[model samples]
Target chain A: MSSGIRVASLDDIPEGEGIAIDKSVTGTADDIALLRDEDGSVWALDDTCTHEDASLADGWVEGGYVECPLHSSKFCLKSGEVQNLPATKNACPHRVEVRDGEVYLFPNEAP
Target chain B: MSSIIEPATGSGAGPSASGGERPVGAATAAPRGALRRPVEMNRNIDVSGLVDAEGGLLDRSVFTDEQVYRQELRRVFAPSWLFLAHTDQFHKPGDFFTTYMGEDPVIVTMDRNRRIRAYLNSCRHRGARVCRADSGATRNFTCTYHGWSFDLEGKLVSVPNKGGYPESFDTKDWGLVEVPHVESYRGLIFGTWNPEPVALREYLGDMAWYMDAMLDHDDEGTVVVGGVHKWVLEGNWKLAAEQFATDWYHVNMSHTSALTVLAPSGKPKAEIVHRTGRQYTDPNGHGAGFPVHPRNRFDAQTVHKWMDYDALRERLGEARVEGPLTNGHATVFPNFSYLPVNGSIRIWHPKGPDRMEVWAWTIVDASMPPEVREAQRLYNLRTFGPSGIFEQDDGENWSECQAIAHGFITNSVPLNYQMGLGSEREDGRHPGTTSELYSDAAGRGFYRHWRELMNTPAWHEENR
Candidate 1:
């Protein structure tokens, strides 16, 4: 019972970093961070850090983990599990698909 | 979610035989007769939901509830081991200091026997405080109210008018009530009122290993320098205690503006956020988190680094010196906490549910040269005393949070504590439950212990 939306093209995001897309996970237009790992797989999570009101897009992404720039709390790119202290809960993980060179997002599933 | 809290309406399960009554040594306005009567708290106020399956739950009532505070005075503060004074504070046999066990005023002393003891500050006859001076050396204390004099051992020595009382009135039965359990570890003194309870060593558990990092740095040991600094904050005591115990996350955000000025180099704000540290949580509600430096870069300028680092390494070994004693904050159970390198030890004395009196001291190596000790003292005051840059910012955050929790709806909402949830690991270098530097696992552990003590009225080792 979810819907898919086209968020970006394969060429729109860099291979080892993430870009913020102006789309919401639950249809109300919230910011979602579209991250491309070094292995070339794209993952989408809510741009906001769950611990505090910081932006995940402004954080540093490396080795399949995104480190919150404000306090350095890390979140895993694959499982969305919080990788460090300060942020105790998992970030919202979204499904991503690349077809016909266009990146699609399915974000109704909760993290 | 099925509520784990028993209905506040029902009697629920009470504590063991010794638990139903409010144990002696806790502060109370009522006399002994009233204390003996059973107090029925709001049984319907189930706190099971206060902590959640995800990691943390918000129950602002713990801070604002009148009923809950009353329970804490009995169920939590009464049996818990509380900080009394430092060992060096009273070196002479007759030396004594006045302090608090919860809200009750007490006198901690080194009697003629040279044994450390604590007694209720209230005079036995009329309940007025017997000892008035903050600290001094006196053979005995005389009650200003009625001239009832007590010896250094807290024994009733003389009464003004002997004819006023009957012949059967023995002075032996009228001495100030002594605190039941008194214990010391290294140089710190702690007391409790539970008649039969676990020893302080068992109560502190593995946290003692971490504590040695600060207390056991050298064979000469640590001493309290620069007397004491006292202040009042309009916040709950638990907020202050919990922050020191497990809230390293708040440092980068709350102290950002202050850190900018304190940074050794230019662009201080950037330096504050770039550092890394690990958090440790214990089953006993004790937690500590400290920044791990590459070869002691953080303390390079301090007196600690000036001392023999190689000697410390030889004494405590590499892992201990790096893990617990380096550069961070720690708390022992309820209220005693300290910063390792910064060297400020404090007790958050609870005054009702929303207020606390902070009694702080600066700790330094007793054997250090006078100039080096003075340098350490000045640094401590500059960094963590009442007027310190970091201390001011921390007090503001706690006070503001307390103000918001007073709201009707806001008090019921759970606060977010989900940083680094389910991502804890077992690292040989670190002890207890180890997690990433930014996780709230320590906070969760702290609250879990709080919940356990709040629910169980007794202070048995099993319950702890």
Candidate 2:
């Protein structure tokens, strides 16, 4: 049996944007960011940027990356890899599943 | 107003040196014992003996000593007026721009009353930065950590959990620390941390008279045209400041390639270098160097067409309009430098003994037409911006100076500033000490003032 928890539905997130799942609800060390690509594919990563105390859900999502609002450090949404300077550490990737239009977060599991 | 932030205890790092303090009630915060200990100020270095302005000699160790750099932050920067931002940057209440006062990050904002105020950017709670963006409009600066927030006047407005704090925890006692002295001359705003400082006009001295050529030429004043260009350079801050103040002589050789590219098709090097020019050195340490006559096609085509020479001459007198007001380079004491010809105004923000970060902007008369302003902006970007041709030429020389100055034997040798010693004269036409354009009088004046500040412990003593 999968230990995934339902977080949100597919229609809840706008295109090229993200929504944050609170740590209390996900039971993880950090908040999880649920991002929707322009093509409607959903990805999950740690919400806090590895470089600073910023919520990636509040960043600008374009293409396959999210740009940190604080310092403009871009990170790959799918793999959680940092793509710029001022941020050398990569954000942790989180597993996500979409079953019948409902979004399920796999707690701390890797994508 | 009550001062909320106490003076840093012991030898705690300045605002720019230290990261955010440990978060309250967090187990992940660094262990108390692991925190940095105060560094003992170096007593062995004789600050007074480092610069012999009369002899035109400067010790190289001044550029390499960590202790000297630390002391300079307190003595030179804390009391001196440093450029913060321009009035044009703030359009409405709560509009702000972030800048540095010698390495210490600060926020310059317009309060609800439209009064300009500046405060240290560090948060009052756990010391995280309150404002991270370069420029923005906001109602309250909410810290990313712990959700502490401050209003436009830097007043502590809210806390995360009101029930968790004891009754003794008062928000009024934890407001952001204000810079204390904020003033403006023309459109440029300047701030100082010292509670008591000389009046801005008195501190500007003769430099104000010289600056009027550019600042007061038009009735509408000036405004920064574009986004700031910033980059780090591996060089001591003084190297850039002093050069802008009094080293126009370097242009003939250091920027030969730039000259070759910029010079008109048939113009000879002799015509550029042999032109008569003047230099001015003020007791306040400000300096300027400019040609007596227009020397380039750019000035003739762009500057002359836009500037009202007749009105400026009538208003400012012929001595200013014809001389120091023309195309030139100048520095306002320690780090604020500008080039009137290129329309570039910059601050050489000291990062460390061996490094400096340059923040540059293009400024133009507000009354100028859009086309003239755009032309000046492009010209400034091509000549003095981060990737400008002349900037690259100058950066190489400055960085190399820092790279070699750290060598044991290299630092022991003193450098020369004796280009035009004793040649400084009081020309009846201009205020302050004047000399032929090639002199290093301004360099000597700069060191003399620097040494004075480094030796004096308090503003009252220095002024006395």
Best by TM-score: 2
* lDDT (10s digit) by residue, model 2, range A1-111: 685999999999988778999999999899999988888888888998786567788666889998775556788988899999667999988888999999999976878
- Clash number by candidate, in order: 22, 0
Off by over 4 Å in 2: A1-111, B1-45, B266-269, B294-300, B459-464
True contacts kept of each: 0.00, 0.00
* Predicted candidate 1 versus true structure: per-residue lDDT over B329-364, tens digit per residue: 888888889998767899999999999999999888
* Candidate 2 lDDT, B85-152, residue by residue in tens: 87888887778999999988898888776667787888866888899899987666778777677777
Measure candidate 2: CA RMSD.
Answer: 10.5
**Residue B188 shift from truth in candidate 2, angstroms:** 0.8
* Model 2 pairs whose backbones collide: none
